[model samples]
Target: MKVKYWTCHSDGCAANVHIDKNDHFIKSHGQHHHIPEPEQIELRNLKGKVKERVITETSSITKIYEEELARSNLSSTALTLAFTAAEG
Candidate 1:
């Protein structure tokens, strides 16, 4: 199919931003080299929220495992094997 687009001129970038005759900006077709300031701040905030959730979940899992180990009679080797199998 014949497609119409504009090539970005930034170094090491291969962006093909679409250009419609009636519109100044449409859709882009590559990894964006730069994000606008507002978008950058929003992305950073999202990253922070994700990191926080990961840390919280990891801590909770660790606490549960520690409690289970303390309360159960399973040997360390058995626990290790069980975890290894679960991982796979």
Candidate 2:
């Protein structure tokens, strides 16, 4: 079956990728693409496996973003007010 892989955009997840068959792409938690070689099936599989590892290392950045957002406590309304006051 064809398989696809996706890496997490976040920088801290050690195994933040997910991979699966092109038909079952989302099920794998990775990305989706068609596998293209009967002879190179092993190599394609290895690529997908590596993507899983990279994703895990990259996911931690999400937590950092969330934590910082929580600490800032700057809501949209507050930001708008601050900007408007500055303009005045």
Candidate 3:
């Protein structure tokens, strides 16, 4: 059976998520060593949305960014983090 591995993002984390071809969860291994960061998660999702739009649209990065930011409804903390990352 074809499967995909979704590994943990935290440093030194050994956790992993396995999914089958149909995107059904097969099983998980190990465990996360840190608590979930909701704000960071929101920022990651926002980046993903922008990336998908960038791939499918001819719009300028600035325009796409503005549009996505408007629709994202991210928390203030997430917004601050996003802008800080962009500046770096």
Over 12-85, each residue of candidate 3 has an lDDT whose tens digit, in order, gives: 99999999999999999998999988998898898899999999999998889889988999899899988888
**15-53: candidate 1 lDDT, tens digit per residue:** 777756765676788875865334334334444554565
Judged by whole-model lDDT over C-alpha atoms, candidate 1 comes out at: 0.55
TM-score of each: 0.28, 0.23, 0.87
CA lDDT for candidate 2: 0.45
RMSD of each: 16.1, 18.1, 1.3
Q: Please write out the lDDT profile of model 2 over residues 1-88, one tens digit for every residue.
A: 5556655433443333444664453443433344333323433443445455557666564454344334444556544443454358
Which residue window of length 10 is worst by lDDT in model 3? 79-88
Question: Which is the winner by lDDT between candidate 1 and candidate 2?
Answer: 1
Q: Note the Cα lDDT for every prediction shown.
A: 0.55, 0.45, 0.91
Off by over 4 Å in 3: none
Give the C-alpha miss distance for residue 71 in model 1, angstroms.
Answer: 77
Ranking by lDDT: 3, 1, 2
Q: Which of the two, 2 or 3, has more TM-score?
A: 3
Off by over 4 Å in 2: 1-38, 58-88
Q: For candidate 2, give the lDDT of residue 38.
A: 38
